[model samples]
Target chain A: MIRVRDLTIRVGSFALEGVSFTVAAGRYAVLMGKTGSGKSTLLEAITGLRPIEAGSVELLGRDVTRLKPADRGVGYVPQDLALFPTMTVREHLAFAQAIRGWDRTPTEQRVAELADLLGIDHLLDRQPQGLSGGEAQRTALGRALSFRPRVLLLDEPLSALDEETREGMYDLLRTVHRETGVTVLHVTHSLTEAKKLGDCIFRLADGKIGEMA
Target chain B: MSSRRRGTTPSTGRSDVPFLVALGVMGGFYVLLIVGMLVADVLSTTPGHLWALLKNRDIRYSIKLSLISCTITAILSVWVAVPLGYLLSRYQFRGKALLDVLLDIPIVLPPLVIGLCLLILFSTPPGRGVQQFVQVTYAIPSVIIAQFAVAAAFAVRTMRVAFDQISPRQEQVALTLGCSRSQAFWRVVLPQARQGVLTAGTVAWARAMGEFGPVLVFSGTTRGYTEVLPTTVFLELSTYSLEGAVAVSVLMVIVALVVLLIVRVYGMGSAPVGGR
Candidate 1:
C-alpha cells in the first residue's frame, strides 16, 4: 500500500495543499485532472524530485518521503517516457536490470520476455526517436517493469497515443497489471481512460484531491 | 490586371534586412580574418621548412605541453562548470543574476588585464605565500590555472545554456522511475546533454590551447616547460624564426579545424533536441 498525507508544494504560481490519498496494494488508482492541476506535482513530490514542504509519503508500508528515488522501490513511467534516447530499447531494459543487480543471463531472458510480451521484440535494437508513440510507451513500460518495483506510477501514459492505440494500451495495461499484480497510480485527465482503467478514481482540481464514486 | 498581393510584406523589409546584413558582415569579417591568417602563414613557410618544423623538438614539446595543459583545463572546467551550470539553469534564487554576470567577467575582460592581475598578486609576498601551497608562480600550474579560469567561464555559459534547453520534465520522470537527484542527473540528464557537453569541452580546450596573454604574464616564456603554441609563436617571432612561428600557427590552425569538425558533428545531433 502507498499513502500520502498533507502533501503541499509551492511551485511558481500554484500551490498544492494538504493533499492526502491512499492506494491499496495491487490496485489501480487513477488521478484525473486537467493540465496544471498539480497532478504531476503530486507525483513529483512523491518521487522526491520536488521537495514537499509538509508531507509524509509512504510506499509499501515504508516511509519514503526522505528516501532517494532509487531506494524508494516505486517504478514511474513519465509522460514523455524519458527513455534514454541515446540507448536502444534492449539497452534500456538491460540498464534497469543491471542497476537492480540482476544477473546477465536472467536479465537477458527477462528482457526478451518483456519485449515479446509488449510485442516490441523486433524493435529492441532501435532508438526511441524512431519508435511510434505506442511502441515508445511499451518500451517505457518494459523499462519500468524490468525493475519490478512494489508500486508503479504512470504519468499520462496513454496521452500521446491515437484513439485506436489508446484503447489497445488500456487492454495491455490491464493485462500487465493483472499478471504482475503491481499497485498502480496513473495520472491522466482522460475521463475515458479513468473509467476504463481505474479501480478507484481521485479527482484533482485546483490542487485539491477528492475521492470520487 | 489585379494587384498581385501575394506574399510581400511592406513592414518586414528594411527592419530585418539591415540588421541581418550587419550581423552577417560582422560574422563574415572574423571568418575572413582567420582564413587569411592561416593561408598567409602556411604560404609564407616553405613546404620543406613546414615539414621540418612539424618534426622539430621545440615544436613537438610545445604541442605536447599545450595539448596536456589545455586538456586538463577542459576537464577541470567541466568539473566545476557542470554543477554550477546545472544549479543556475534549474533553480531560481537570490543573487542568481549577479552570479550569472560574474561568470561572464572573464569572457569580456581584456586578457592583458587578467594576466597583470595574476602577476601582481602572485609576484608579491602575500600572493607568493598563498602560492607556496600550490606553487603556481611561473609554473605549469599557473598556465593551467589561467586556462582554467578563462575556459571554465566560457564552459559555464555554454553548459548552462545547454542544460536550460533540456526540459525539467526529463529529470522529473527519472525521479518517478526511482532515481535520486544525482542518479537522475547521471543516468538521464547527463546522457541527454552529452553532445552539448562535448561541444563545450572542445570549444574550451581550443580556447585554452590558443591562450596567450594571461599565460605569458603568469608563466613567462620558459621553453619546454611553460611555453604553449601561441607563446611559442611569439618566442619564434622575437627570435626572428619566422618559419618556425608560421609553422606553429599552422599547427594551431589544424588543431582548431579538428575542434570545429567535432563541434559540427555535435551540432547536427543536438539540433533535433533543440527543435523539440
Candidate 2:
C-alpha cells in the first residue's frame, strides 16, 4: 500500500501544495494530469529523488519520507524508461537482485523466470536499443518487478508508444497487476488509459490532487 | 500558372556556392598553415638524414624519454581527471564554480608562468620538505610533473564533457533498483564512460608530447634526462639543426596521428552508450 498525506513540494516558481493520495494494497491506481502540471515532481518526491517541503510518505505501512531511495524498496519506471543501454535484457532483470547480493545461480533463475513471465525470454540477450516499444516496455516493467517491491510507481509509462503498442501494453499491465498483486500508482495524462486500467483515478490540477467524479 | 514538379531530395533549389566558398576560404587558411608547415619540414631534409639523427644516443634517449614521460603523464592525468571530472559534472557545491575556474588555470595560464610558479613553489618550505625525500626540481620527475601540470587539464575537460553527456537519470534509476550511489556510478556510469576515457588518454598523451615551455624552464633541457620531443625541437633550432627540428616535429605529428586514429576507431565501437 502507498499513502502520501499533505505532501508539498516546490521547484523554482512551480509549487504543489497539500497534495494527498493513497493506493490500497493490490489495487491499480492511476494519477492523471496534463503536461507541465507537476506530476513528475510529485512522483519524484515520493521516490526520494526530490526533497519534499511538507509531507509524509508511507510505503507498505512504514514511513519512508526520511529513508534513502534504495532503502524504500519501491520500483520506479520513469517516463523515458531509463534502461541502461549497455546492459542486456537479462542483466536488467538481474540488476536489483544482484545489488542485494543474490548469487549467480538464483539470480539467473529469477531472471529467466521474469523474462518468461514478461514474454521477453527470446530477447534476453538483446540490449534495449534493439527492443521495440512494447518489448522495451515489458523489459522495463520486468526490471521494475524483478525485486518484487510492494509498491510499483510508473511515471507516464506509455506516453511514448504508438496506439497498437499501447493497446498491447494495457493488457500486459493488467496481467502484471493481477499476477503480482503489487500496489501500482501509474501516472499519465490519458483518461482512456486511466479508465482502461485504474481501479481508482486521482487528478492533479492547480497543484492539488483530486478524485474525478 | 506554371506547375513544377517537387524534387524528391531534400535540397535547396540553388547551390549555396558563395556561402560555401566563404566558409571554405576561412577554414582553408588554418588547413593551409598546417599542411604548408608539414610540406616545408619534409622538404628541408631527406628520410635518410632524419633516420640518421635517430641513430644519435642523445636523440634516441630524447625519443624514449618523450614516449615514457608522455605515457606516464597521461595515466596520471586520467587518474586525477576521472574523479575530479565526475565530481564537477554531478554535483553542485558552494565553491564549485570557483573550483572549476581553478582547474582551468593550467589550461589558460602561460606555460612560462606556470613553470616559474612551480619554481617558486618548490623554493617554499613544504616543497623543500618534499624534496628532502626526493628532488623534484631539474630532474626526470620534474619533466613528467611539468607535462602533467598542463595535460591533466585537457583530460579533465574531456572527462567533464563525457560525464555531462550522460543522463543522471541512469544512476537515479540504478538507485531505485537497489544500488547505492557509489554502486550505481561504478556499475552503470563508469563502464559507459570507456570511450571518454580513451579519448581523454589520447588528448593527454598528445598534449604531453607537445609540452615544451614548462619543461624547458623548469627541467632545463638537460639532454638524455629531461629533454622530451618538444624541448628537443627547441634544442635543434637553437643549434641551427633544422633537419633535426623538422624530423622530431614530424615524428611527434606521426605519433599523435596514430593515437588519435586508435581512439576514433575504438570510440566508434562503443558509440551506443554515448546517449541516455
Candidate 3:
C-alpha cells in the first residue's frame, strides 16, 4: 500500500498544495485531471524527483518520505519511457541486472521472461531507435519490472500511442497488473480509462485531491 | 543521346532555391581549397628527400612528442569532461550559464594569449601557483596542460550539445526501474550520447594534436623535450633546413589525413542510429 499525506511542491509558475491520497496494494488507482493539474507532479513528488515542501509518503507502512528515489523500491515509467539509446535492447536488459548487482545468468533469464510476457522477445536484439510505440512501451515496462518494484507509477503511458495501439496497451497493462499484483498508480486525463481500469478514482484539480470515487 | 537532357538545376527534388545557391557558393569554395591543397601536396612530394628526412633525430622527436602529449591531453580531457558535460546537461542549478561560460573561456582566447598566460602563470615565484602545486612548468606536463586547456574546452562544448540533443525522459524511466541516478546515467543516458561523445572527443583530440602556439610558449621549443612537430618545423625553417621542414609538414598532413579518415568511418557507422 502507498499513502501520500499533505504533499506540496512549487515548480516554476506551477504549484501543488496539500495533495494527499492512498493506493491499496494490488489496486489500480487512477488520478484524473486535465493538463497542468499536478497529476505528473504528484507522481514525481512520490518518487522523490520533485521536492515536497510539506508531506509524508508511506509505502508498505514504512516512511519513505526522506528516502532517496533509488532507495524507494518504486518503479516509475515516465511518459517517454527513457530507454538508453546507446544500448541494444539486449544490453539494456543486462544493464538492468548489472545495476542491482544481480547475477548475470539470472538477469538474462528474467529479461527473457519479461520480454516473452510483454511480447517483445523478438525485439531484444534491437535498439530503442527501431522500436514501435507499443514495442517501446513494452520494453520500458519490462525494464521497470526487472527489479521487481513494489509499486509502479505510470505517467500518461497510453497518451503517446495511436488509438489502436493504446487500446492494445491498455489490455496488456490490465493483464500485466493481474499477473504481477503490483500496486499501480496510473495518472491520466482520460475519464474513460479511469472508469475502465481504475478500481478507485481520485480527482485532482489545482494540485489538490478534491474527492475519491 | 536521343532524348536525354541535363541542366544546372538539381534533379533530386529538394528545391530550396536560395538556400541551395548559398550552400553551393560556400561548399564550392571549400571543395576547391581542399582539392587544390591535395594536388599541391601530392605534386610537392619528392621521394628521395622524403625518405631521408625521416632519419633526422629532431624530426623523429617532434613527431613522437606531439603524439604522446596530445594523446595524454585527449585522455585527461575526456576523463573530466564526460561527467561535467553530463551534469551540466541534465541538472538545473545556480550559475549554470556562468559555469558554462567559464568552461568555454579557453576556446575563445587566442592561442598565443593562452601561451602567454601560461608563461606568466608558470614562470616564477610570485605567479607560480600552478607550478608550485603541480610542477608542470616548462616541461611536457606544461604542454599537456596547454593542450588540455583547449581540448577540454572543445570536448565540454561538444558533449554538452550532444547531451542536450538527448531527451532527459530516457533516464527518468530508468530511475523508475529501481536504478540509481548514476546507474540510469551510465545505462541509458551515456549510451544514447555515445556518438556525440565520440565525435566530440575526435574533434577535441584533433584540435589538441594540431595545436602549436600555446604548446610552444608553455613547453618551450627544446629538442627531444618539448619540440613537437610544428615547433620543429618552425626551428627547421628558421635554420634553413628547408627540405626537413617540408618533410615534417608532409608528415603532419599524413597524420591529419589518417585521423580524418578514421573519424569519417566511425561517424558514418554511428550516424544512422541517432537519426531516429
Query: Which candidate ranks first by lDDT, i.e. highest?
Result: 2
Model 3 misplaced stretches (Cα beyond 4 Å): A90-95, B1-18, B93-95, B125-137, B240-244, B267-272
Model 1 earns a TM-score of: 0.83
> In model 2, what are the clashing residue pairs, if there are any?
none
Ranked candidates (lDDT, high to low)? 2, 1, 3
* Candidate lDDT (C-alpha), each: 0.84, 0.89, 0.81
lDDT of 3 at B198: 77
State which docking tier applies to candidate 2: medium
Q: What fraction of the correct interface contacts does each predicted structure contain?
A: 0.52, 0.73, 0.62
Model 2 Cα displacement at A125 (Å)? 1.3
User: Model 2: DockQ against the native?
Assistant: 0.68
lDDT by residue (tens digit), candidate 3, A107-188: 8888888888788889988988899888888877877777887798888988888999988988998998998999999999
Would you list the rank order by DockQ, best first?
2, 3, 1
Q: Is candidate 1 or candidate 2 better by TM-score?
A: 2
Please state the error at residue A65 of candidate 3 in Å. 1.5
lDDT of 1 by residue, B203-241 (tens): 789889878989998889998889889999999999998
Clashing pairs in 1: A69-B178, A70-B178
Clashing pairs in 3: A76-B176, A82-B170, A84-B188, A86-B191, A86-B192
Interface C-alpha RMSD per candidate, 1 decimal: 3.2, 2.0, 2.4
